[model samples]
Target: MADIVGSMRVFVRVVETGSFTAVAKENDVTAAQISRAVTALEEQLHAALLHRTTRHLSLTEAGSRFYERAKAILADLDAATDEARNASVSPAGKLRLHCAPGLAQSTVAAALVGYQRDYPDVTVELKIEQSMPNLVEDGYDVSLISATQLPDSIYVAQALGSAWSVMVASPDYVKRNGMPLTYDDLATHTLLKLETPVSPPDEWHLQSTDDAHVLPLTHAPLQVNAPDVMRAMLLNGAGIGTLATYSAVEDLAAGTLVRVLPQYRVRPFTVFAVYPSRRYLEAKVRTLLDHLRATLTPALEAVGERVEAMTNTIGEAAGQAAKSA
Candidate 1:
């Protein structure tokens, strides 16, 4: 009839302290109340768990065996409670993070650096792949995805920012081959294509102020699965290829690579930090999501601004050239 778990605690304390009086004093309860708790536990188990006298108390054979198991169980329960409480308050333990490979190097990696510095107890396991991983199956705490649509309705997504592909070529290649003035001009030039598991390999979806177009590159001379490889090839004047704005921000800023189409835009994809729809969000997961949004949103915005500035510069130059002609 007595609280079974509470009785166990009293029994363990009585055995540890060697006297009901001592545990009673420790818990600010009377010795008789402590004795009643042990009696209830013994009655529930139908086994005498202690050999008691006025001056001495000791565990019986059965009591000794039960004591060992009970102590272990209590210790494990205490540890589990502490772990859960700590995880809710402080960011600690291993957090598996899955991210798209193209954003891994610049945006995700940079945010993780600051996150680790802030939360030293949280160990981050970062996995970068081109394909989206199953978060619940793979045991990932969070995933950063760049896509037009969310993979499933089960995930809670926070939009980090927008991501888009941009057609880029080296300044030297533009000078020699002439810049593609329109989407139609892309057909006459050598095109470097990105082959990915998620998207069509030879097709690009482009948009303008008033219309959207899907351009299929049927004669791409070079194709690769890696974004870095595509960037390298474009830098070497291999051909015009589409690079994610985040991937090509540096090249565009340095004037090494120029945006090919100023008037047209690639279809933009939203970047989201997604996690399972759970009742409670752990501190580690929530903090990292916040860190990602704070860092990546600005980084993506900066890339957009830089690309826009470059586009305006190119447009102004073209207009001046027309006047001179």
Candidate 2:
């Protein structure tokens, strides 16, 4: 009966959606799995539930009658479970998340630790990979991706926020080498590359409100593949490198790393929370997405605010120095 109950839900969705693929996407399973579920339901009841063809699916007479009953039964089961589960209706299960190497190291890792504290029922498995995987194929409940733009897909996405890339160097390095006040100053300094999924390794594109510049520094052949690695190298005074604000926020606040050119932003990338489907989204996945929006949005916004403040402070100081001179 328990087995029958699960398949019945799939059968109902297939009937309602009129396509196995649609139900498959909603359940984050393959269309074949949806077809098997309906087929299993038919075998259990000894009656055909749906007529299938290459173009579409149509409910058989028995299926029409069964779908109505099954929908009602599932509703009642949900109510009963909710009542038994108490007021919170906490979702209890394993939640899997896919993340790129950079974001997993920076913001998502901290957010997951906090989420675990808030929702003890969900156990998260974070898979750190450099490339994006198919959410359905990989069986990840959610994926947090960082890139300049999201690749076109059928999955639903909620954009958490954006983070900017900035040139940074250790405080000691700045004191010894002198700060690069203008773009031309960068050519003489030791330059390094920080490679992420979105950023190109060969050059840097810097933009200010009034000016746009490109610095193709072909020296100091050090390149790191991850943001954390880039931050570590910069903290040790390796060379001036690009670090995403999401990765640099803590160090910036601690004054461990200072923004080199406060007036110009190197580039910006977006972080997106993507999942298989919006409908019937699992409680754990939905809650985690909400938590991330609350967590990541403020951090992203802070980067912008901090950069703006730095620009103002630098401009004011330059004005003072010019007047004094």
lDDT of 2 by residue, 37-142 (tens): 7788788889987888899788889888988889999999999887545423465688989998767876788889999899998899999887778889889898
Error of 1 at 196 (Å): 4.4
Per-residue alpha-carbon lDDT of candidate 1 for residues 1-325, written as tens digits (9 for 90 to 100): 6678788899999999899999999899899999998998999999999999889999999999989989998999899999998888889999999988788888788889999999999999999888878789989999887887775578888889986888899999999999988778988998888975435787888887878888888898899988888998999999898888888888988999988886777778888888886567899998897788788889888878877888788789989999999
lDDT of 1 at 284: 95
List candidate 2 stretches off by more than 4 Å.
1-90
TM-scores, each model vs. reference: 0.86, 0.69
lDDT of each: 0.86, 0.82
Q: By lDDT, who's the top model here?
A: 1
Model 2 root-mean-square deviation: 12.4
Estimate candidate 2's alpha-carbon lDDT, on a 0 to 1 scale.
Answer: 0.82
- Model 2 reaches what TM-score against the true structure? 0.69
Model 1 ranges with Cα > 4 A deviation:
1-7, 16-47, 52-58, 196-199
